[model samples]
Structure formats: C-alpha cells, structure tokens
Target: MNYTDEEICTQYGDRPKDNRGAVSPPIYQTSLFTFDTFEAFTHAQLYERENYVYTRGVNPTTELLEEKLALLERGEKCKCFGSGMGAISSVFFSLLKSGDHVLFVNNIYGPTQQLLEHLQNFNIEHSFSNGDVESDIKPHTKLIYVESPGTMLMKVVDLRKISTIAKKHGIYTAIDNTWATPIFQKPITLGFDLSIHSLTKYIGGHSDVVGGAVVGTHELIDRIFTYGFQLNGSVLSPQDASLIIRGLRTLPLRMKQHQDNCLRVIQYLTTKEEVLKINHPSQWKGGAFSFIDDQMTGYSGLLSIELKEGGFKKVAAFINQLSIFKIGVSWGGYESLVNSPIKENNELELIEQGIGTGIIRFSIGLEGSDLVIADLEKGFQALHSIKS
Candidate 1:
C-alpha cells in the first residue's frame, strides 16, 4: 500500500492504462483539444481551469507533469510555464494588487530582484531583509518571498519562522525550492503557501529543457492559472513536458550522486589554504544552520567558495585555469559549471552584499569527485600566480 519516493518519481500518475498503453507517456502535441459536441465545448470552456480546452490553458502532457510536481511537493494544484521567471511573474501578478508590498528574505536570485524593481512601476513595493522580519513587516505587506540556500552565499532562512509569521499576519509565503527540490524539502509540509521550482534545472536533469512550475493550494493555484498562466499565455510545450517527465524518473539517483560528489568536493576545499570559506549547507558550522537537517534530507551540488585574498583578476585567473569544470551559468545539469557574482565593476554592490571579489560558485556535475577536486587544485594554483 505504501510507495517510496523513487516509486513516486517513476510510477505515480503514470499508468499505461491510457494512450494505447504506451510505456512512455505520449506527447499531446496539439494546440487545442476538440469536443464532439457544441454543448460539450461550452462546458469545457466554462471549466477551462480543469478541462482540456487549449494548450495555453491546459495540455494532458503538461498537466501530467503538473500533477506529478504537485504530488512531489505535497501541494494541491500546480501550473507549468515557459520559464522559471514566467512562473514567478505569474505568482506576483496574480496574488498582488496595486499598492501591495512584498517582503524579500535572505539572498534572492538576481533576476527576481530585478523583476521586483520592475513591479515598482505599478505602485507595488518591496523590502529586502536579512532576518529582521519584525522591522520589515508593513501594513500593506501581502507576501513573504524567500529562497533557502539562496544565490551565491547559500544563505538559508528559517522556513518555519517565515511561515508562522506570515500566517499570524494573514500574509502568504512562497519559496524557491529549486535548490533543494521536493526530494529534500517540501515547503507545503513546512507551512509555506507556495513552492516554486525551475524545472530547467535538476528536475529536467539535462540542460535540454527550460521550464518552470508553481505548486500550492487549489485556490491560489487556480487564481494564478487564470491571470498569470492562461491570460498572460506563458505555456509549457508538450515536448518539454515529456522531457521533464523523463528527467524526474531518475531524480532520486541523480540527486544522490550530486550530493555525494558535492560533499567530497567540500571536504577537499576545507583542507586548502586558498579556500577562505565554503558556503554550503553541509559545511555550515553555527547554530543558525542547525535546522538544516530538520528541514532538508539532502542538498544540491551548487556551492561557493571565498578565496583568502583576491579581486576580479584573481578570481578570473582561478576559473580560467580549471579544465574539467566549464565556466558558465544556470546550474543543475550533468556537467560541472563555474561562475562568479563578483565582477570588476561591481565593488559597491559586492560590498553591499557583504561578499568579497574572491567568491566562486560551483555547480558540481556527475563527474567523479576526484576529477572535480583535482581541477580545483589547479584553479588554486592559478589564484596564487596572480600575486606575481
């Protein structure tokens, strides 16, 4: 009667009973579905949110992916979008009205902050807070948006604290759960109102697909579906949906391998003189990160390291020296990647972020741990030569 997480990933919501019993879920590639009768067509339009009307509103392929994602996150409803920002924008446009305020916690994604700045044109406002939730809460605050193990530093905010505060004040809370995925952290179980993920990352496993999803209660999700999803028309294609489903089938196996490789890399970094600090959940040393184990079962391979001393040229030198790791952006793939938030012209912003120019974020891939560590050793040598 009981099924395991791997079973849920591979088996749940996928039954061969339909579609001529094809072992793989067939892609319903049509733009719209037709009803046999006009009366049936009207009925479908009336219940467009639940019925198969058009691909813009719903598609069997995307819907299957949505159902699986909702189940994975333990949420009631779900919506898929063309990109992660599309999902995020829909959530913002659907839930927020004129003059409403949003409270951003910890280090949020750069593009997300840019989107919030854009919203200011419509009279919506936001405030970024480290941990002082009490000071930031305003009378017009409508939502508390946060990212755990966020951005480069991997700063984690207390989800329980955020949810409880939001509920006490009648505010909705949402989290970017892409880093942890549903495999490690279920925001709904932690009392968050909405959980968002960039399926282009780990859920897709491969870098071939670019999609996003939002999961939460039926009421909120339906509202987003109407305004943010259907009306705005950022829809996920059936081809992408099928691709994401294939990725989900091996999520358990891929995630475990990523974690194993990351931990090994972290251990090696801790022993190096060039590494000033390792920014990842497992390496967190203080009580501030104590709830990590309680909230998450595991972590992703994404992490950042601060060099003992460096600037833009030094960091660039280190990254340029790496062979196995490719210098790039947008992680959560089978290939290792390297990037830096610190740039030559962003000194003031870096100071505001409280990070140095020496930070390098790494996205460890399925490659062996020994290969990753050996490349990093070369990168450190490049860092040292910069002094000359």
Candidate 2:
C-alpha cells in the first residue's frame, strides 16, 4: 500500500507487544542469537532474513531499521551498512562482473569516482555521462548510476527518462538520493532499480550516526547482502540503528523546516551582489522546474553559490568570517556548514566536474533564516575586504 511519507515515517517500524509493550524498539546488541536445537539453527541459516543467526549477517535492531528504510524508499528490501561508501561499493561489487561497464551521470559524489578508479584493478570500466543516457550507453554497459541535484552543483537529472533508457538497454539504474531524501523523492516509484542513502545525513538527522543503505528488489538486495555486505563486514551497529530509528520518527518535520529555510536562504542569496550564480533546482530554467515540481515533494537544505569574483584567498577569507555556519565536511546535521570545492593549495576536482573556484556549498541547518542570512552578509563583507 502507498502511504504518505509523514504517515510512513511515524508508523512503519512499530514494535510488537512482545517486548513488554514498549513504544521504542529495543536494541538487540548481541553477536549471535542462540538456537534451541540443530533443526532450528538449520532453518535460521536457510532463511536468514526470517530469523537472525549472527549479528554480522543480521540483527533484530538493524533489521527493523532496514525494514523501515525499505518502506520509505518504496522498495522490496534494504540493507544498512557502516558507511555510505560501503553501501555504494557493495552494489557495484555484487552486480558488476570484471568486464562490466558503468555509466555515471553528472556530478556524482567524489568518493564514488575514487571507488570506480579502484575497481579498475578488477577489470571494471566506468565513464562519466553528459546526462544523455542513450548516447552514453555502450554494449558492455551494465549499470547507469546517477545523483540528482548532484553534489556541489545541485544539478538535477531526469530520473524517469534515465530509467526508461536503462529499461530499453536491459541495464540497472541506481541513484544516491541523499539530497532529496525519501520524504521528497522515491526513485523506485519512478522506475529506478535501486535507491541508496547515506543515513548519516538526513535519515540519521542528528549527525550522531554514520551509516548507509540500499533499497531495491528482494533479489537484488539479497545478492548484495550475501555477496558484498557480509563479505566486506560493513555492518551497522545496533546502537546506531536505534539512533536512526529515533531520527526517522521526526524526519518529516525536519525536512519541512529544511525546505522552508532553504527557500528563504535562496531568496536572500539572490539579492547579494557577491553571489554570481546559484545552483539549485528551484532556480533552473527550461522546463527543469516542471520535472522537479512533479517528481519531488520538497527541496532539502543544500545549495551551491559562486562568488562574483574571487580566487582561493578570497574564498578562504569568506569562509573564515562565518560565525554560525561551521567550516566542515559532511552536512545534513542540525548545524549549518560551509565548504569550498577548491580548498587552499589543493588540486581542483570540482573544476573537472564544472564547479568553479570560488563556489561554496551550503548545507543550511535548522537555524532561523534571519540569523543565517545575517551570518552570510558578514561573510560577503569579509570577501569584499579581501577583494580590496
């Protein structure tokens, strides 16, 4: 049954009356579950998902979190991992043979590119696309991976169109839906094969946990679970799983506030002369908004802005002057963050991805819009002084 994201967020992972009728699910923090007999052990081994045998293979706490995530993504199953990279690597290792090729759509996560580079030792090939799925596909192309409202640039891809092309080519489609979250966009509903999330972000919500998940068909997820997840030992701790559960309960509310604050910040940014360009789905032209409006329920608190004129020194000055927004990596927490694609004395990867030198990526937190805007104004003043 199709449930609203708000309803699913609150209702999907309710524990039964077996645990003294507790409202919150208890953490099953154990290495293994003991079986009463050999027959029972054999049954658990045969049907791993139905019964927990080992914490490495399955844990009740993690399983409950997985079930809730699967429902949120509108998928048949989901498997959580120790980190976002773990989830992504498991998918690639499970599905791709030595000679298989993957076509990555625009502006994918930086670590994903590194992962593909490492996969070259195993004879896997990958290429970046200009968003033309049909033209980019080669005979050996087995998968099409995309990140919509992509990292740094906030570029949006047409998922339905990409999924349709993948279907025609008999290839699987996967997406890093971390930006939109399941509350905003469900790629599976639009025909994508898999939807992955870095649960450390919005799903975990509090910036307290580090984890990832892949949501897809029972068969596909099971293959990843067996071949990649277990073998790699990228298991989510029961404590972390419990924290994510608490985060899920308030996800809908958090996302709403995020969207509202993002809109306000974007509006404020438009009036700043130092702001050369804004990269956001809401600001796109040429029918981009039509797809965004139709596919996504809301936008998250992430956007990129290019300074009017600056090099690395000016960029550093601007970042240093910000008081409320902390200078750090990995956003989607309760605190605002500011990061530059071009770090001091560092080689430019963002430039290769078409991001500019003075571009700053903002992950607006649950702060008041007025206060956040004021902080940015001071940052701009610092940039002005540096430019002088």
Cα lDDT computed for each candidate against the true fold: 0.90, 0.89
Sliding window of 10 residues with minimal summed lDDT for model 1: 1-10
Question: lDDT per residue, candidate 2, 1-388, as tens digits?
Answer: 7777777777666755777888887899898999889999998899886788998898989998998889889899999999999999999989999999999997889899999999999999999896567998999999999999798888898888899999999999999999999999999999999999999999999989999999999999989998889999899999999999899999999999988998999999999888899988878755555677667878899998998775789888988999999999998988899998786665366566577887988999998889999999888888867742
Clashing pairs in 2: none
Best by lDDT: 1
Error of 1 at 287 (Å): 2.3
Q: Where in model 2 is the C-alpha error above 4 Å?
A: 285-289, 346-350
TM-score, cand. 2: 0.97
Clashing pairs for model 1 are none
- Deviation from native of the Cα of residue 385 in model 2, angstroms: 1.1
lDDT of 1: 0.90
Backbone clashes per model, in order? 0, 0
Report residue 311 deviation for candidate 1 (angstroms): 0.6
